[model samples]
Target: MTTVTLSGVGAAMPQPGDAPSSLEWLIYQSATAALVDAGLTRAELDGVVIAASDQVDGRAISSMLTSGPAGAYLNEEINVASSPAHALVTAYLQILSGTHERLLVSSWGKASETAGGSIQAAERLSVEPFYERDGGLSALAATALQASAHRAAAPDRARAEAAAAAVAARNHADGMTPADVLASPLVAWPLRALECPRETDAAFSIVVERSGRAGSEGISLDGAGWCTDSGRVAERDLVGLPHLARAAADAYERAGVRDAAAEVGDWQLHDYSPDAELLAYAPLGLCAPEEALELALAGAQPVNRGGGSLRGEAPFGGPLRKVVDAVSQLRAGAGVERAVAQIAGGFAGQFQTVLVIGRQA
Candidate 1:
């Protein structure tokens, strides 16, 4: 396997007190910012890989829709059409294959265009048409089942909720209390409205290079693993995702990790819903799900130091921002030597992807 380095990272979003911008503008902003961060001109990019969603972008061919915006205009572009993490891994593989030396990875989504229940309806339609669509399986309901399962399986349900609530309070952007999180109206039995991520429109761009070939200011992109499970959420055991566990194991092995629970410096798991972070603990080798929540609330883990997705998140760009934030932290010398950016797609995390990035060889 060949290692790669993230040479640059940049993003665009609506600043506080500023009005929202077009998706195209956001993409352009990030694309240009990424080139600046890499200290390279646009002429150096050999190709581009974009992650996008047709449903979220509200278009037929999302790749074609974003070509100009993402700065891939006349260049060879490969669209992952899945999670942004998938696009990042694809770029890594291309570098490893020696077919490409430098690539720009980008992804974006604008939830503001179709507000109200339009986005929700489109998401519900993503379910298996024959098996799940008619039954109306959407993001909220799928996550609600998972939350309910976690609540039922825990030894001390109140303590678990309290721990999750404490972590939730820490993620409220500004000042927020545990009582506030607990008081929020329930979205779907057991999952309060505040526990869910606040949707936002955003875009992210990254530059990657082949091993031993990047500038001195980059972070190493060492190991990655992606896998998909049954899309039928009702069929799988909600308590544990075996395939996600295997994906984590594969990522850890590739990263030469012996004990992830104690080794990793950053845990950027895609906590899509309330307590979702707790559920991911054991699967990603952090700890028993029961203990993970407690550890997280007690300040024992680095899970979502910047509030994860709960603070503010992009609909299709969740994975993209995770990678971008990790890069920013690594660059800031924030006591992080290694970081894992994880994302999920499909039903109940039917697809899981992991990227283990570090500062060393």
Candidate 2:
């Protein structure tokens, strides 16, 4: 098997409605910066893989307009409509096939460009028209439903609240107290305004190469696994996150990781909501679902060092940001030999992807 390394990463964070640059410009800046970080030029790239959402981009076939900016000029290009982490997975497999030696993966979300109510309309359209869509089942409602279910199963609301506060504090300079989080406006039955992530206009790019091909030492892409649950929301095991468990299991086996809690040092979780992060504990083999909050409040788990989605979520690009953060940590000698980056996509966390990264030995 060919070892794949994440050679470099770059990103552009523009406050919504504050930057005059177009979305393409953000992509170009990040892609070019990644190439520079990797000590490579566009002429040396084999291909480009992009992850984007047509609805969020406010254009049909958005990739056609965006690929060139991603350094895909005259080169092979592929697009993933799913999470940006999936683009990394695609690039990794392509390298293993020996058909491509180097690939650039890119994704972005310009939520600021979306018209009012359009983003929610896009989320509603994800469900079947006949049943779920007619019931006003948007992403927020579904996540609230899942959180409600998780609360019912665990029945430890205070601990869960504390854990969420801990995460918020870790990510934000002025962390919210559990009371503050609860006092925030209740968007859904159980989800509060503070508990949900704020949307941001952000873009990320990563340079991946077959190990030794770039002649640049980098973080090793040790393992990757992704799984999608049934599209029907009612069919999913909301509290269990079974798909996440399966994906993590697959990734762990590939990386030869038998004990994740003991072996992996950092966790970059794509937390759509505070409960969503708690739900992932058991699935990722980090801890039991019930114990997750306890461990989090106790400062035992090294999850979300980069503030996760709580800080700013860029729709499809959030997962790619997690990958970038993981690689940065490893390269900076974060005292961990290995780390895990997990991303969720689709409505109510239906799709899950896990990547295990390690420092070059």
Candidate 3:
């Protein structure tokens, strides 16, 4: 098979306390960081793929904001205002399809500038208008509802919740406490402030190269894949996701992983909402439906090792940040022999993307 390699990677967010830069400025910073990481310049870029959330950008077409800054140089350019992993999937397909070899993937979000309810405004209107938007349901409420259903299936709420909190506290950049999680105030029935993704303004960039070439650091983008599920929350089973299962299965197959729970090294699973992380456990084959807590307590696997979006609080940029973290883990020798990164979105349990990167060819 024709393989792809990630040659460079970089991330940039607005300087804290500084006047937030324009969307274009964010794009420039991300692109610049990635090019520098790859040891390439704007003069070498021939393709640009951007991922974002239109709602976060408060713009109809978020890519319109990045055109000039992305260094497309009048070459092929594409943008998907979805998850950054989704964008990476799209870019990977383009490269394998022979449209482009050198791909630049970037994502940005500035939730700080907007109303920042995160619940009422962060989801998809096209898919879950009634339950997610029309009913004024926030992501926390939806996740709480799903969590409630999940807990019913398993009966160990405190342990699972604690395990989730431990994962968050350990991997996060700031290393928040379980007490901080406990006292953060409830968002839904059982979901607390600490259990949710912290909203922040951030941007990320990555360069995936085709095989037979290497980045400045000799890193490679071996394999990656992203997948999704149905939208309507009412029609699907809320307690679990078959879609992410399919995604993980496919990504594992492509990456030549036989037993994910045994073979994988570190992981950067999306934990945007604690409920989502709990649900993801079973689907990704990381653990059984209710065994997540026991496995978590044992510390068998270091999930959300980079702290995930929960600690970073950058929603739209979370997936790319996760991918960047996965790349770092692989390059830094922090994972098993391999690592996997997963990202998901959409309302009512829909849309998921999983990427598995390994050290071997």
Candidate 4:
């Protein structure tokens, strides 16, 4: 097997109305920035892997419009309609197969162009039209169901909410308290507005190359795994996140990680909701589900040091951004020797993927 590493990463996360640039411009900006950071010309690239959504991009066959801006012109290109982390998984496999030496992976989301109600309607459509959709299940409602399950499983609801607030406060500039979080309007039955991620328009690009090919040492992508659970919401063990557990186990086994809590220095779990982050801790082997709230309150691990999605989340690009952040931290010698980035797709987090990256092979 050949080793693969991330050579460079770039991102464009402009707030709504903060920049006049179109989505294509943001894609081009990030792609060009990544190539520049890698010290490689676009002509040297082997191919490009893109992560995007036609519904979110507001165009049918959206990749056709995005491929050129992503430096894929006249080159092999493929798109993953799922999360951007899956795009990285595809790129990694391509490089490991020796079919490509160096590849550019890009992902973006322009939430600014879509209306909130429209997005929610799109999410509602993702449910099973036969039953779930008729029951009024949208993404927010599914997540609320999961949160309600977590709330029931929790030994102490007040303590769990406090811990959740503490996690959110870490990302807020003004800082927030448990009282503040509780006082916020409840978007879902059990989830407060502050506990949910704010959607943003953003793009991210990464340069991945086979080890020893780029003339520059980069952060190694040691292992990766992904899995999808049954689409039926009732069938899932909402509190366990079994699919995520399986994915993480596969990744850890491939990486020879026997004790993730001790060996992995940083963690970037998709925090679509604060409870979603907590739900991940046990699955990722960071802690027991019962102990997750306490672990979070204690700040015992280096989880979401970049603030996770609580700061700003780009639906398509968010997961890839976490990978970029992990690579940046490892490269900067930020006391992190290894990191794990996790992402999910589908309604109610039905799909899960995990990547273990390290400073050394």
Runs of candidate 4 with Cα error greater than 4 angstroms are: none
The per-model lDDT (C-alpha) reads 0.80, 0.84, 0.72, 0.84
User: What is candidate 2's TM-score against the reference?
Assistant: 0.96
Q: Model 4, range 1-361, lDDT digits (tens) per residue?
A: 5778888888988864574778899999899998888888899998999998887888989999999999998999999887787899999889888889999999998777785667777777777777667898877788888888887889998887777777766644255666787789999988888887777778999998998864546688889989988989888998899999999998999888999999999898877777888889999999877789988888667887767777777766666788888887788786789999898877778889999999974
Off by over 4 Å in 1: 213-217
Against the hidden reference, what TM-scores do the models get? Answer: 0.95, 0.96, 0.91, 0.96
lDDT of 2 at 214: 38
Worst lDDT run of 10 residues, candidate 3, spans 118-127
Question: What does candidate 1 score in Cα RMSD to the true structure?
Answer: 1.7
Query: After aligning candidate 2 to the native by TM-score, how far in Å is the CA of 135 from where it should be?
Result: 1.0
Model 1 lDDT per residue over 174-237, tens place: 6788899899998888889888887777899999888565463458887888888877787887
Q: Is candidate 1 or candidate 2 better by lDDT?
A: 2
Give me the displacement of residue 319 in model 4, in angstroms. 2.2
Better model by TM-score: candidate 3 vs candidate 4: 4
Model 2, 130-224: lDDT tens per residue?
Answer: 76778988877888888888777776776776777666656543555666776788888778888778877788999989998635566889899
Q: lDDT, candidate 4, residue 258?
A: 94
The segments of candidate 3 whose C-alpha lies over 4 angstroms from its true place after superposition are 116-119, 122-133, 214-217
